[model samples]
Target chain A: MSERVVAAAEEGQVVELRRSGRRPRAVANGVRAAAILVALVVLAVFPLVFSNPAVTTIAFFTLVFMTSTTAWNGFAGYSGYIPLGHAVFFGTGAYTLAIVAQDLHMPGGYGVFWLVPLAGAAALVVAIPFGLIALRTRRHTFVVITIAIFFIFQLLSFNLGITQGSSGIQTPTPPWFGGAFNIPFYYVGAVILVLSIAVSWFIRRSRFGLQTLAIRDDEDRARGLGVQVGRVKLVGYVISAIPVGMVGALYAYFIGQIFPQSAFDPLFDITIALMAFLGGLGTVSGPLLGALVLEPLQQYFTVSDPSYYLIAYGALFLIVILALPRGVVPTVGAWIGNRRARRAAPSPAAAGEASGGAPGGTRYAATVRSGE
Target chain B: MALLEMEDVRKSFGGLQALSACSLEVEEGSIAGLIGPNGSGKTTLFNIVTGYERIREGAVRFRGTAITNSTPERVFALGIGRTFQLTRIFTRLSVVENMLVATQRHEGWLRSVLRPAGSASEHRRAMELLDFVGIARLADAPAGTLSYGQRKLLDLACVLVADPSVILLDEPAGGINPTLIGLLAQRIRELNRQGKTFLIVEHNMEFVMSLCHRVTVMDFGKTIVSGPPDVVRSDRRVLDAYLGTEEADGDEAP
Candidate 1:
């Protein structure tokens, strides 16, 4: 009567065992807070802890690489648009700072620092039209378009007399502030890394993040659900470009020079992309973790044998892709989550009691119900 | 006046003529059904009204505002929400996260980045809808893992979280179990009682007959008959449209 057995069976298994919320917000928040505290402590004392000029230099580069990769991951990783030529923005930022400072005869140190944001702004502006055109085509097409743009910029820098042709422009070093200039540059790089990470964290939990993920999952469905796909992508592109641009400006200043080949290096894009993929594509900290691991490895390889470094890099990438296809963070997270779920599963007697139904009757009824 | 109105809407994909001179209306608080044999432009009409596809001929008005060629987001903002024939939930996201995405609006771009995903009230409403759909327990489960029937329910819940005045459901009973179909019907009736207007395109005759306040039958992208289910079910033209497709090929006389 009134589908009594059906109701009992549903209560017995599915309804009885089901947990409403699984996010574990409190525990996650605590863990995140603790991790942030530990990271900040380590970062603050890093220069002091290492006390080696070579180590500090490498650490500075690591921070710069982490900032750029994290910024790239914010949009490309989240939206599933592999930007093959993201170096466009990075190069643009470097070149903009170089051109402006040279053309304007700007003084070094704080005077030039004032225009760093302008470099970032220039890259952001450039990304708008480029993103609009490139995002019109998706997946592989978009990747190709980005690569085309990057190479075009590279060729322009090499040929344009305004950019000093192939010889490149020599940047003025910033006014030294107490000891080696690299110390201040290191701290600045660290600050940029922290800012980029914060931006990534913010976007990952924001409404904008949800829309991007929706687009990544299915563009048509996202549009159908009232997400302005074109506009969201453009905004995300601009945001992503801003940090990379700032980093480029910093890098140009740090090295006291900007060359067409180095400023617009295609390897920058490839390396950052590889870093993001190696860690976890969509996770906020993935790119940072990736940069930490891969940048040091690259540095070591480059010092040992610069010519064969790239071959080794390629081999390492293939190994990661073949062995851990889902990347480290997600693969490990999924494994731990599955184990936890198994341990959390209720026993049969406990499940029956929780269901508030006759054990034997509901168990038999549940078997029949599941057969459908 | 009808809550939603389509006046002589016509659409064509090159030469196929997906919809031709189609017109229908859904009154306030009524469950209106659109049915056809296979492809009589039922979905086409729904697409036109929801702004998924453009209408070549006529106008679509919602609450007396002409929204003939409005974008899907504009249509949704105007309180018209819809679900696809095939369920289109964001597969990688959790069920609650999917619901939150649907509840989002196109506001300030910077604000979206600055603010968190959904307000407390929005979260409450999303959870309530999930509960109403009987899938609250699966709120954190990735949507891809859900059964086809459960995905369908989640799809409906996503639309409901928007709290639209009018909902367009394309094939609400397609490929679902009978028990779930009955539950779906009950939910529709309950929502209708609360003054939510629905325009549903369903192939299941029994489900439509039991749930729809009135039914419209279409043949060859034209409305063949429109009335109460019993009347449309027994109409000569309707029967011919469903049973003998060849006989109803030519244009009907005015």
Candidate 2:
């Protein structure tokens, strides 16, 4: 009878079932959540036992890439803005920190830290004008506009000595952490990763997030429904730039080097875009998963033959686009949900009859039996 | 005085004269109907009056205010809510969410960002509107998942949520099942009795004749007749414009 009631509700029959006051489903959900939490906690603290500096450094780079991918995914996946020019923001952040540390001769770590967020702000300023122009066009045209803007920025950076043209700026290592291997950097990167996750979580649950989803589904209809489409898209674009910019600055500082060619590299944009797309768009954990899985492979390629890295990346992008268009999370989520539903035994109709036969079937049972 | 008046409204799309010096008036708190054959400028007049399309030459006055060249958003803010011929419901959003988007509120973007969705009043009002439109049961369901008739009801619910003084329904019964058409008529009459004015464009002559207090007939961008439904239905010009040469042949046969 309970199964029948659930089935009726699924079919939209409007069956008002009596409350049993039993909390089995709640208990099950709690247990599932706690298990996941425990698993995460174990993973977070597990590295302490290994104590390898090389592994810690690689993990730090993975976290930074994860942050960039998460922010990029939010805009491109949910909002449906194909931002081919994210490198503009990323490059800006890298150059901003590089210039501040090298030319300005500011105090090492703290100076670069304060300047990093400023780079994000500067990237936001650039994004505003770019968004205004790009958002005026639709779909493929918008993509072209973003790509063109990035190319323009790349060419200008190459011509101007402000960013050291092709040679690039040398980022100064912090005086205090100069000799230390990797633990402090690992902690900092982990914190940034947590912060990125929190920001992504906030965005997904916010009113802005809902509006972006509506805009993505149908812009003209969204407009008719009173959504300020242009303003919403612009805000999303600007918000997406912040983390990418900050990560770029951190990358420059970590490597103790920066160059126009390296800072504005198309590979940076393609890799982040590929990570976000492959993991899934519009999902909070997708980019993180993409970064975690793909970054290691990318590191391997860099070590093996750096020149052929683009070919491998390009092939992976093609495979992801063709196979998992909805992204990994939603596709896998739907499959798991379907599998669980299929495993539940004894058809609801049969259960309804079995229960209805019991002692003049209760009023609620009659409603459920009627399938109304 | 007319609550909404259009004087010599002329609108043209390049060579096509959609509204050739058309004129009409809608009295306050009355259910008015606009009807004609296909391409008779019924929708064009609605577009011009509601500020969706620009008029080449005309004056549109609403409550003694000139709204000739106002934007659609401005016209909506000025108390004119409209539904499209194609039922423009936000498909991916829930039925309640669709209505919520249209609710009258002072919360700008900044306030919406800061506040976790406002008081229960807005939500309660949205639920009331949904119930009024007979879609309360489907309130939580996605609007796109609704049947065609249900989507039409949702569109009406969204318009009603705005609490507009006057509503311009492009077609309240277009492509709707007969049973749903009856329900739509009843709802329109109920709202009209409650002092809400409506200007509806409908192709269903039977439904229009039964529900509309006054009917305006147009042809080739001009008003052919305007009077009570019975009188306008019998007008020679309306018949000629609607039936063409068949009107004369039918007169002799029947």
Candidate 3:
């Protein structure tokens, strides 16, 4: 009886040791949540701190790209369908806001914000037909189809009389000017980005997102298991379109002008894809991280050297492709995962997975593997 | 009574005739076995019943309902589940998550999106099935890290989540070791004793002969002979089909 008590005491110590090992990781999670809280507080008061118009303007575009890139991830990342033509929806949103503002002759101010959701709805409506045609194709063909649809939209905007035909449409300039002028733009951009991120977060947690990830991993197998893959793709596409359209509407008001070429810019598609890929595709936080890091640099370069800016971006993208093929966020995520796995279990294979630095980057990144 | 039927199923790819008037019937409460040489249209028949490929001229019925040309999701919802020959588990998903994916067909996408991910009962069912298949310890690990044999086990567990009346396992014992094969066979027996029906396509003759109540043999896209395992074991036609000819030069049936 005494010996059994001693054995029980020893077992308690071992259990306590295991529990203590897990405590630090739990503490690490607490630290991460604290970091996010601090970041949110900093972002909330950024415009007040900087106050410079140029800085506010840069912050505004950064938020816009972040929103749109996240929206793109909601579909393209989850579905493993890289679209080379999301400009179609962005252009549609811009035009919707423009036409509505014109038809009502409403003096554009805070009142215009009411129509922002209208612009989002309009873009969503347009996405249905676009998705119907494009989703029937697979992988690389889907990319080509998106490009074709984007070009068609650009051509229509170039010739349509209401779009001003090779000229442009301009929004009413805000009565406010200077640093104060960009305050609304920055905050509005921030608000939409937060909403987009929330929507994406829910999607990542939902069953629909699981099916989408399954489709991304192996569409045929997903179908065999009873996932309605086509329907999931369509819903994801529309879910992705709303925030993008909202961002496009905000962009039109900020620039005070909308051009067919600029509104339907082909680079919009490439830039967002780059942003998502540069951080980590198919992740909740990846596109946001990418846009935050890259957009300010991009804007600064465009302001300083417009002619040579894209070349610099091209070189940077090449280096990213070679150095961290899965992108920074996923690589870092994998490294963390490896550490956690080692801490939990000293398995030999975990070390190799850490060094390989590619496979099992994250659950999200694992789904968006190299496509057929 | 037939739980699943592929009657006079005919399919072709380009100029090659893959399934020339193939027909198969699986009984309601028995473990039915299908054995055939490679490229003899066994997998093709599975594809047709699951609605991955449109039937050129055939009909599939499940529990007296005509389901020809139904979608794969429709087939699964109507109480049939399948696993691929290559073991297509979602490599990125955790093993338990992979099992839960099979439980989603009943919920429409919107309803599924609005609700919480898995109910307490649903998660309990998933874990019980994982334990039943001996993968409960690996439930939190990504499915990709599983060995080839373990992946095959995971695929079986994934299909069993829906508790479909009929299961079509393509190559359940194709490349796994004897130990896993024994475990898989034992699990199938356990499930079969519970009244679940299985339609298995396997190349392991010994496993089929030992496990199946009834066995069907196919060659060149047509059923040659089908009967009890002992009868098929002694049949001359089974020999002719496997060895390509009645040979006296130390040749044997596969």
Which one is best on DockQ?
3
Q: Give the Å shift of residue A211 in candidate 1.
A: 1.8
DockQ of each: 0.37, 0.29, 0.47
Can you list the residue pairs that collide in candidate 3?
Answer: none
- In model 2, which runs have C-alpha deviations exceeding 4 angstroms? A1-51, A176-181, A340-372, B44-56, B59-61, B68-71, B117-119, B246-254
Model 1 per-residue lDDT at A305 = 85
- lDDT for B153 in candidate 3 is 83
- What is candidate 3's fraction of native contacts? 0.50
**Candidate 3 chain A: worst-modelled 10 consecutive residues by lDDT:** A1-10
Worst 10 residues of 3 chain B by lDDT: B245-254
Q: What's the candidate order when arranged by decreasing TM-score?
A: 3, 1, 2
In model 1, which runs have C-alpha deviations exceeding 4 angstroms? Answer: A1-28, A175-179, A346-372, B245-254
lDDT of 3 by residue, B85-174 (tens): 999998877777888878886888888777666778889999999889877766765677566877888899888898888999999998
- What is the per-residue lDDT of model 2 for residues B148-238, given as tens digits with 9 covering 90 to 100? 7788888888878768889999888999888888889999999999989999899999988998889998899988789999999888888
